[model samples]
Target: MNTTEIFLIAMLIIFSLPWLVWRVFNTDYFAPLVVVQIIMGILLGPGVLGKWSPEYYQFVFTPAVVQSLNGIAWWAVMLFVMIAGVELDLAQAWKHRRESGITAGLALGSPLLLGCGAALVLLQFPGWMGPLAQHWQFVLGIGMACAVTALPILILLMEKLEILRHPLGQRILRYASLDDIAIWGVLALILMDWSRIGKQVVFLIAFVLLGWGFRRLMAWLQERDRWYVALIWLAACGFGADWAGLHYMVGAFLAGAIMDAHWFDQDRLDQLRHHVLLVMMPVFFLSTGLRTNWAVGGAEVFAAAALLLFVSVAGKLIGVRIAGRVLGWGPGEASVIGWLLQTKALIMIIFANILLDKQVITSETFTALLLMAVASTMLTVPVVAPRMSAHR
Candidate 1:
């Protein structure tokens, strides 16, 4: 719609070439690909590019660019969900479902309590959000987002470091998948802006039933190569949730959980991950960096950031360890597995972004949490991956 948008578009295309080239040549530093794209977005964003020549920047920031970039980001998320769904060893995961479920619940619950405990005292702000923040719902959400470990980054780290098949990796993967869903469900509960408990219950029943039926039909059809049928299911799951007052991620996660890919094929899932990471994900990260407003979110945000990062990492590690001990796990084994599973990724980012976009979170909150995620991703991934591999 504006000149600034147009310039950003041209620049994104120009920048994407180098990113794509680098992706093919070397996959060594995939994390930095996200960093680089964000930097590009910031440079082209209001402060630098727009400041230099407002008119020129406006040309770059056209309506077309806005629409296209947003579309690409959405596509990346779909790929992320598909990969997540496809890789799941549902049968194995379900067989160990009790252990997995316990680990997941504790892993989610502990961080949630810790983050909310910190937020109540430290993350104080005034005015409109304060009312919402005062409620347990906001506290629950911020806590969950703060505590999530990135599943995608963990998989990448475990693979690159040659630890994916290790005992520690296996244990962590089993627990993390369960934990990811548990945490998401908790958020879904918080997100259901209903006035009464009965209303919420009704909504859940309708949502789950619709989701189950849709997924069953999808599996039946897709087993027969019916992608057109798959598309209808996708629309139902996605738009259906939008209509029902839930996030698309809920529907997407439900879709993944229900389609229930069997574990006989690992290579196809791996290929799917490769295709998504190489082609589409940079756009998502680009959108992340562009949406972020680091300039205004300075000193105050960092304090909250430090707390969120620490609480998130520590609580999950401790909770998982506690669960392991309860299940008669060895201390060293539990520690390694706990540490390995705590790395967070795209789902975490999207959750935080959703809150931010809904105006439920401040820009400062969003920026700090997101950047902390990037940092935590960098830190925890390398450490646990190597340790897990050696232990195996």
Candidate 2:
């Protein structure tokens, strides 16, 4: 078959397998279609399907087909990240400054500290740290991964629970929004290249000026024109960030972060996100899965993943519990909020992917982190649903 046929075949498999599993197994309550797709990606990767059927894997995922898929995944993820950036309602977060700041700080810092400890333990073993990473870089990267809250996924889950517009849900969004900014800021710090500092500095300055002008332009344009302009901005920012050695995903986030979400229709924005996930993100997941390696041993990877998950969940709960005490939240509020804040699906995966791309963490570590993200996200709805219902 030609490359086109092979790529289509790959896409068909990517889209179909996850849906079949979600429907046939009725995993929606626990494992959403996105979660199933992520697992499916890993299963179809070299560690599982490729190992069992190297010939088939190679034939289906040829170099040309892989490249094609990667292109789609890149744009897909960029758009998704941009949406995440635009969704950041920092204004509301600031309006609830004391509450949001206290919760966001502890929520992020506690996991970071615990995750750093976990990273320290992993460092004792070989095959965990990436080649290009300094000891500090690897440690900090993993720690931050554990601390990350998937704001986009959190929003989705909140909407599903019918609390998206509720006061409690709005408060959760504020906390997550604050943490989201910190997460990206720390990522920029981690990705800083001393050798390319000049370029990065220049990029930042240029980004500010361009952002101001772009925002002005966006305000002037009709909503329909804004969508096209946003894509153009996305491409430009992505290229500039990649050129500055900070990664295009960071650029994508910045591109949307500076823009006002209210400029576009909320329903359209939500639909765009959903369509991206439906059509493009599965390919990204498959590509992500293709990178998973268990050379360090599957048992070790699972163990590490479990350790990360434990610290991630525990730290978030403990930190939020502290905040709850200080703020005098009603009983059960902290637990519910803590569990909801622990959702780490897409953003954590994206963060880990950047780490892997930068060689800040090895494939084994990536696999473990990926597993932790999946497990962490899966736990959110199951744990939080009952709490939310009871609290209501």
Candidate 3:
């Protein structure tokens, strides 16, 4: 078949198989459609499908076809990340700064320390660190990945639990918002290149000045006009960030972060997010799966994933529990909050993807991070549901 035929075939598998499995098996209670889609991405990746049927995998995922899909995936993820940025309730976080800081800090720091330790251990072995990575870069990158909370996925889970607007849910959102900012800040730090430092500095200054004008322009425009301008801004920021050597995704987040969520209709914004997930993000997931490799050996990769998962869960729970004590949270509150905060799927995956893209971590490490993210997210609802009910 031609490239177009092969690409369409690939898209067919990407969208259909995940939906069928999600519906047929009724996995929504424990594994939401998003979680199942992520798992399906893994199953469809080189590690599984390619291993089983090399020729079929290669035929369908030819370089040209993969390239075409990547273009879609890049834009899809950029839009998603930008939305995540716009949705960050930083104003609320600032309002609750003391509480938010304590929770967000411990929650992020503990996992980072533990994850760095794990990275240290992994450094002793081969096939984990990427060729371009410094020892410090590998350790810090993995450490931050462990500390990440997928704010977008967390919001989805909270909405599912019917607590998104509840007091406790709002509290959780505040904590996550602060951590979200820190996550990107650390990413910028890790991605900084001495050679390109000047360019990055220039980009930041220009962004600040242009972002001010952009925000003002957005505020004056009608809502309908704002949407088109926002897309144009996204494209520009993505290009500028890529040019600055900080990655286009960073630019995408900045594009949204600078814009006020109040400038658009909340319901429509939510609908846009839903539609993006429905239509485009599965392509991102498939492309992500396409990047997975088991060259380090399946057992080894699984071991690394298990290791990362343990630290991510343990550190999050430990840190949150500490915060609960300091804040005098009610009995069992920490457990509930901890479990909810431990949810990691999209954001952690995105962070690891950046690390993988920058060659700070090998594909083996990326595969492991992918597995850890899926497992971490899958545990959130099942583990927290009963605890939440007990309290109710």
Candidate 4:
């Protein structure tokens, strides 16, 4: 068969299988289609399907077909990350600086500390850290992965729970928004290549100047014109960042971060995000899945995943509870907020992917982190739903 035919078959599997499972089992209450899709990606990956039927896997996911799918996935994730950046309401976060800072700090810092400790334990073993990583890089990267909260996924979950527009929901956004900024900052630190430091410095300086002009230009353009201009800007920023030895994903985030979300219609921006997820992100998910491995052993990977999940969930809850006490939050507030903050899916996976790409973490570590992300996300709805009901 032609490469195009094989690629189409891959796409068919990517889109169809997850939706079928979600619908057939009526798993919406616990496992949303997104969650189902992620799980399906793992099941379809080399660790599972490829292991079982290497011939069929190779036939469908030929080198050409994989390359084609990767192109789509790259663009998909770039757009998705850009949208996440565009949605950041820094102004609002600033307005609630005290509360947001306290909450976001503890929420992020606690898990980071705990995850670092976990990474230390894992270091005693082989096959966990990447070949290119230094001890500090590996620890910090894994720590930050645990601390990450997927803002996009959090928004989606909040909307599902019918609290997206509520005051509580707005507050959660503020906390998550602050942490989102920190997540990228830490990512930049992790990606720093000392030999290319000069280029990275130049890129930052140019980014700031260009960003100023770009924002002004965006402000001047009509909403209809801004969309096309934004894509052009996205491509340029991504290229510049990649050239500077910083990842293009960072550049994509910056491209959208500087542009005011108000410049475009909110409904249109939301629709664009939804459409990207519907049409493109499944390809990204599949590509991510294809990278999963269990050379360290499947049981070991699951064990590591469970350990990370424990620290991630416990640390978030503990930190938030501390914040609640210090800030004097009402009863049950911390529990609900903590559970919501613990949700990690797209953003954490993206962070892990970057770590994997940078050779800061091995595929074994990536697989474990991926499992933790999926399991943590699945826990969000079930745990938060009951608490939200009680509050209501």
Tell me, what's the RMSD of every candidate? 4.0, 0.6, 0.7, 0.7
- Tens digits of per-residue lDDT for model 1, 5-34: 564556566467547654775634445454
Clashes of 2: 0
Deviating ranges (above 4 Å) for candidate 3: none
| Candidate 1 wrong stretches, greater than 4 Å | 1-57, 127-134, 195-219, 222-228, 263-265, 328-331, 389-392
Instruction: Give the range where candidate 2 is weakest over 10 consecutive residues by summed lDDT.
Output: 380-389
TM-score between candidate 2 and the true structure = 0.99
lDDT of 1 at 319: 87
lDDT of 1 at 365: 67
lDDT of 1 at 303: 64
Model 2, CA-based lDDT: 0.95
lDDT of 4 at 270: 89
Residue 184 lDDT, candidate 4, scale 0-100: 95
lDDT (Cα atoms) of all candidates against the true structure: 0.65, 0.95, 0.93, 0.93
What would the per-residue lDDT of candidate 3 be over residues 87-132, giving only the tens digit for each residue?
9988898888899999999999999999999999999999999999
List model 2 lDDT by residue over 242-306, tens digit each. 99999999999999899998999999999999999888899999999999999999999999999
Cα lDDT for residue 33, model 4? 83
Which candidate number has the best lDDT? 2
